[model samples]
Target chain A: MIVATSGLTKRFGRVTAVRDVTLEVPRGVRFGLLGPNGSGKTTLVRMLLGLVHATSGSIEVLGEPMPRRARVVLPRVGALVEGPAAWGHLSGRANLRLLDAAGPGRSRHRRKRVDAVLEQVGLGGIDRRPVRAYSLGMRQRLGIAAALLREPELLLLDEPTNGLDPRGIQEMRALLTSLNEAGTTVVLSSHLLTEVEALCTHVGVMDAGRLALDSELAALRTPTGRVLVRTPEPDAVVGLLDGQVVDRRGDTVTVRGVEPATLNARLVAGGVRVTGLSEERRTLEQVVLELTGSGTDRVDRSPHGRRPEGPR
Target chain B: MIGVELRLMLRRRRVWLCWVLLCTLPTLVAILLATTRLAPPPGRGGAFLSAVTSNGQIFPAAALALVIPIFLPITVAIVAGDTVAGEASAGTLRYLLVRPVGRVRLLLAKLISVAAFVLLAVLFVTLVSYVVGVAAFGFGPDASLGGTGAIPSLSGVELTPVDVVARTATTVGYLALCMLALGAVGLFFSTLTDSPLAATLGVLAFVVASAALQPLDAASAIEPYLPTSHWLAWIDLFRDPILWTNVRGGALVQLGYVVVAFGAAWANFSTKDVTT
Candidate 1:
């Protein structure tokens, strides 16, 4: 794993920001940290970056224990924590050069690297513009460019698409996808499910300072071999159904592990009024709602894809 | 890197303004004194006024002494207070710390950069004073600021012109070191807050308080150790056989401050959570 945390926890006064979050992100994959506002995502990311001291437990980045060894591990890991913090007085190129000079290792080809990263992030022509004049999207791109200055093997971005328009978000998605494709491990946090759904290969859901769910994106999206049916008199329809996932929510009844036609026929035979039938693809967003809606006190996942089989 | 910090320091318009202001003050005073027949009053400005009329060569030394009470220290204070807090307020300190370099190195680089600024500010003040002083009044071998009462002296030191110039250089160097302690105070406050103005005012407040307490007989016991207490003690350097007592004491006290303040700054910064 490129990043691993075991029983990690953080608390501010009486509030716990993260609780027993044993997360692991394998190398060479795009991992998305999904959470609602105030959920432990930023706190977790800060702890991993050594900006916040963890209350208990352990964290290791690139196989090195953090933050005891952050100085050694962090240089190899690139990050844009929270929002883009650009110096208003300096041009984008000057900002990158100064930040690079302050980096842990000597950058031998800084001029070339600065130009290349600027071009890579699509800010080449605007390198000379003072950061204060740059648009919000432009500043965010510069922040990403700064993170990529070292060509780090792992990148951690917190809400990297913030203040970005749709076109800018697409560009950011493309940049992160390409970085991951080229063997860079990425873990980005966002409260927007669509952003994560469109980019990530894996997803971790946090809710009110707890890890509500952790699973492969593919698994999270896969059907739990279930179908949902909305019908009146669900309790009476349950006796007519052979499927075990006969859950009644409000006036609707969902029957899992049974063909929709078979379940529909049975409900009809029992003189039950069936109004709805739909396949449950169980996208990660749905899983998020299911998990956080249940509570912020425990971890949960889709039953069909709870554990990824075989080698990671 | 220290070079980058230094560049950033030199790039600010306020820095240039401070230096430019320092350079022109002595020039204005020298020009005004040389072109006029009005002698300054008998007590405070008398020594510099009397000496500057005939030999303006003493203008730089006298200007330095005049400004030492406030101007030069204020310039240093502004720069020093801005060191860490300036970057913090700008939201740049977090990015710098996230880089591979440690906080200790960053703090050291900041202190060094400010120290260099103090050196440059003092140099500009004195150099400009010398040029303007020599222009307004003729340059020549100078009499001592000793027994003649051009300035009061603790000892009657008969000195050659070359020795006088050398002693002036030593006095300037010692004053620069004392400013380091003042700057260190600014640096420490800088790490505690993000407002550059707050830090600058903090150092100025220290200077004002220290000076305010200096004349109090009741506080005299505690006053001598204040950073500003022995600032003018360099006057004794001009005495016959050069009185070293107060000069040595002043520099040592400043050194003690530098050690304590810098040590505290480093300790606080290294473990500081970079929330900004």
Candidate 2:
């Protein structure tokens, strides 16, 4: 594992920011931490970097016990937390140079690495401009460049696409994919389900400071082999199929446990004309909502004999 | 890294502005004293050097005293206040912390930079004043200290221009110690607060409170212990019969404050969870 946390915990006064979060990030994998706002993603990342002390539990990054020996470990790790925080008065190149000076790179190697990272992040042309003048997307890229300066083995990025436009997001995804392909493990926190789905190999869903689910993207998106049918008569088909009703709109019925062939045959045999029939594969977003219990509330319970689990 | 920090300092326009003001203040004062005809006492030339150099000691020290209450604290505030919180605000704190450098070394680098600025400011004040004072008043030996109390009076020592410059340099060294204590205090407050304004104000408030407490004659026994009280002890060098005891005591007190203030700053900065 490139990064591992066992029973990792953090608290601010009386409020626990992260509670018993246990996760393992394999090397060269793009892992996504999916959560809503204030769901402890930032806190967990801080603990892993030793930026904040963990209240309890253990964190190991690159095989080194966190925080206690992070000084020895951090050189191999890179991170961008929250937003880009560079000196507004200094140029982007100067900002990188200052951070680079503090890293383990030699003087000649420092300049070369800074130049390479700047070019890699598409910031080569604007390195001379003061950071205050850079746009939000540009700033974010500069931040990534700073993080990549040392070619760290593990990169922990928090909301790397927070304010990016579509093109910027695409660029970031490409950059991350390339980094991962080159054998760098990446742990990215984002609320954008599409981004996570498109980029992450594994995902961890967090809700209210606790891990709701953790697994590979493929497993989380395992095919349900069910199709949703929208018919004018949901009540008529209820008795005709052996599937459970997941949701019901004015004329749409989302059914589970029934294959598309069986559902189509049953609906036609019952003299019901299917207006809309489409296969539904579990999206990471849907899986997240289901695991976190948001999907349970909107699910229809009448005539299905399935009771929603009580709140945890 | 400190070398990089120094480059950052040099590139800042504010530092240049500070340099201008520092160089100009003493020269202006020297010109004003020379152009204005103050009635001379018994020994004319000796009286002139005494008055000007005495003023040199107190005036520059006073300038440093005032500058520190406002500018030095702000300088320290600008750098130290931004150390962690500013980085946090900029979203670079984590980036920097994740580098190989230890937090202790980073903090030490910043502290050293602030110390360099304080020393530079002190040296500027001393050199500028000495150069302008010597140019305005004729270069002569300090008068022998035959008259005033245990405070040795410089009445007959035919000190040349070089001797006067050397004496001024010595006084500046003493004054540097005092300003360094103030700088360290400013750094301590800066480390404690996130807002630069708050840190600057807090250090000033402490200085003001200490100064207010220093004048209570009833508290004379404790007055010497306060950092502000010994600020003027550099004047002992100008006295007819120099009082080494007061100077020595003042130096010790200043040193003690520097150690304590820096120690507190180091402890707080190293341990605080930097969340911005």
Candidate 3:
């Protein structure tokens, strides 16, 4: 494992920002930390980076005890905390140079390294404007560039795609994917399910400061032991299935207690036109919603505690 | 890390502006004094102001007196207070910490930067005032005949040019130590909060409280211990034989403040969970 925390917990006064979260990330996987807003994702990420000391438990990164050996381990790690931050008066390139100089990077290649990371993050032609003048997307890119300055073996990003446009997000995904392909371990925290779905090989869901779920994408998206059939003759298909249809919406029927192949053969044998038939599997959204609670952003006063549910 | 911090400090427009403003105050005073030819009556205005009209070489000491009470401390407090708190509010502290800039190392760098700003501001003020004083008043009568002028000490005796330079250099070092003590206080308050403004205000409040309590007969029991009480002791550097008593006491007091304040800062900062 590249990053491991056993029973890690953090408290801020009366609030327990992170509960006993024992998480592990292997050496070459894209791990997406999923959570609602204010569900301790940022706190946990800070703890991992040793910016926020844990109240209890232990953390190990790069096979060394965290914070104690942080000096040794963190040099090989890159991170973008809650958001991008730079000396507003300095240009993005200057900010990168200073941050690099503050650490243990070789000074001989500092200029070339900064330029390369800027190019990698699609800011190759950036001018000498101070970071304060950059748009939000530009700042986000600069933050990513700072994280990549040392060509770290592990990349820990929190909301890295925030303030980014669709194209920027796509580019970031490609960048992260390529970096991971080159033997880097990438762990990013975000609430965007589709982003996680498209990029991460493994996912962890956090709810109310607790690690509610930790599983591989494939494992969590396991078949629900049902088949989804789409046909123009929905009524005919339902009739032939003999009440095995658990749900019906227009031309589609969810059939249980049957395999896709058996269901398709039965449908054709019953003279029902089957336009589409496939096994039902849970999407990342469904899995997350099932594992986590309501969005912490919402405050409801209803006595019955009923919330307008689904994704926040 | 210290080098980077110093570079950042030197590059900041605010630091340079503070330096300019510090030097400008004394230059304006020199202009007003030179134009009017009416110095404040003896012992009535800033410490050496009454003596400045007769000797340009003495203006540096007078200039130091003019700014030491308010300008120097205020600017030092502002810069020092901004050290860690400014980075925290700007959201850069976390990044630096994660860069593996050791907590102790970063704090040391910040303290050194604050000290550097103090030295820079004090040196600029001294240099600018020296030039302004010479242009406005000319060298004293003794030096006008191409002879080395003698500057009167705080006592009645005369100080040769070499003595004047040596005393002024000593005054510079002493004042730097005093301001560094205040900077250490700023560093401590900076670690206590994330707002640089709050930290600066806290440092100012500390100074105000010290100054307020210094002259009160009821507070005399602790007067010798107050940080601001001995700040003027640098004036004793110009005494004929050099009054080392208060100067020595002031150095010790300021050194004590530096040790305690920096210790508190390091203790609080090293373990701080930098959520910002």
Candidate 4:
């Protein structure tokens, strides 16, 4: 494993941000951490980078215990957290140079590496422009360029696609894919389930300061072919069918643990008039929502139960 | 890296304006005094240098004094205040921290860059004052005492114009060191606070409070040791009989301040979590 957390916990005053979360990310794997706002994704990333102190438990990065000698270990890791930050007055290239001067690369290699990373991030020719003039997406790209300048073995990106348009997002996805193909381990935290599903080989879902689930993407997405059928006679179909009703809304029934053919056959045999029968292959988004106990209908329930479905 | 930092500091129009105002204030006072008339045997020229030196050394030195508590310290505070906090505010500190560089090295670089600004601002003020003084008054070496009210005739010294400029430069150097102590304090406060305004005002408050406390008879013994008290020691340079005792004390106090402030700044910065 390239990154592993065992019983990791963090608290702030009266609130817990992360609690007893255990996760293992393998080398050269693109791992995704999925959660909503305030779900402790940012807090966990900060702890992993040694920026925030872990309240309890241990974190090992690249097989070395974190924070004990983070200075030595961090050099091999690159990251883009929150947003891009550089001196507004300085040109983008100058900002890169300043960081390059302090990075692990030698002075002789600095310029070449900076140029290459800038190109890799699709920011090659505009290095002379002042950062103040750069757009939000451009600034984000510049930040990714800075992170890649050292050719680090591990890359940790938090919302790296933020501010990117559809095309920019595609380019960034391609860049990350290429980087991963080059054997670099990647750990990215994002709320974009589609993006994570496209890029990551493994996934971890977080909820209420705990790891709800962590598994390989393939295993977590085990091909459970299921479908939902909407009809006026759900009870009649249920009586005639061997399929399980995973969910029911009025007369509509969401049936699972059966193939589409078997489900359609049962519904028809029961003399039920089906208004809709759509096959539902589990999307990473649904799996994430289910694992985190944040299903579309269930997520609105308050912890105190004063209101079953309070305002989100 | 320092060059990049300096460029960013100078790029702000406000920094340039502050630099100009600091450098020209003494000269402006000298010109005003030179154009005006004065009483009896002393005449306008005598009164001008006297007023200019007193006001120059005091107000400009007070201005120079203000550098620690007011300008340079605030500038240092603005720069150092932003070092981590600004980056945090902008969401960049985390990006920088995750780089291969050690936290200590990053902070040391920032401190050195801020220190360079302190030195440059002090030098700018001194250089402009010297040019303006020579232009307003003829290039002559004259000395006057601040509190004693004694004036030394320039005729006896027989010093050349070059020697006068050299002496003024030395005086400015000493004053710069004294003010740098305050800059260090500002830098320390900058590390402690996330808001630039808070860090800048915090140093100003320290200066104002220290100066206010200096006049109390009850606190007389400790007042001389305060940073504000030593601010006027630069006037001792103009005294007919130079006081090395006060100069030494000022230098030592300034040194002690620099050590403590910088030590505190470094300690706080290195351990601080860069989580905005």
Find the candidate with the highest TM-score and give its number.
3
Preferred candidate (lDDT higher): 1 or 3: 3
Q: Top lDDT: which candidate number?
A: 3
- lDDT for each candidate structure: 0.81, 0.73, 0.92, 0.72
Each candidate: fraction of true contacts kept? Answer: 0.56, 0.72, 0.89, 0.68
Candidate 3 lDDT by residue in tens digits, B173-248: 9999999999999999999999999999999999999999998999999999999998899998988898899999
- How many Å off is the CA of B7 in candidate 1? 1.9
> Could you give the interface RMSD of each candidate, to one decimal?
1.6, 1.7, 0.7, 2.3
lDDT for B209 in candidate 1 is 91
Q: Which 10-residue window in model 3 chain B sums to the lowest lDDT?
A: B145-154
Instruction: Give a tens-digit lDDT track for model 4, residues A1-312.
Output: 999999999887667888998999989899999987777888899899999888899999989999887877888888887767887767888888877775554688777877899889898888477898999999999988987877889999999999999999999999999999999998999988998999999998888678888889988776556677888887876776644877778887878788878778867776888888877667897788776745333446458877663211
Chain B TM-scores of the candidates: 0.91, 0.76, 0.98, 0.77
List, residue by residue over A64-106, the lDDT tens digit for candidate 2: 9988888778888888887767878899998988888866667
Candidate 2's residue-wise lDDT over B91-201, tens digit each?
555666777667667666666766677678778766565556556653322323432211113553333444444555666778768766776777677668667666657
The digit string of per-residue lDDT tens for model 4 on B100-183 reads 556666666666666666677777876666556545543322433323322232232233334444544655776667666776
TM-score of each: 0.84, 0.83, 0.96, 0.83
What fraction of the genuine interface contacts, i.e. the true contacts, does candidate 2 reproduce? 0.72
Q: What does candidate 3's lDDT look like per residue over A18-84, in tens digits?
A: 8999999999999999999988899899988989899999999999998899999899999999999
Order of quality (TM-score): 3, 1, 2, 4
Candidates 2 and 3, the one with greater lDDT: 3
Off by over 4 Å in 3: A232-251, A302-312
User: Which residue pairs does candidate 4 place in steric collision?
Assistant: none
User: Looking at candidate 4, what is the lDDT of residue B60?
Assistant: 35
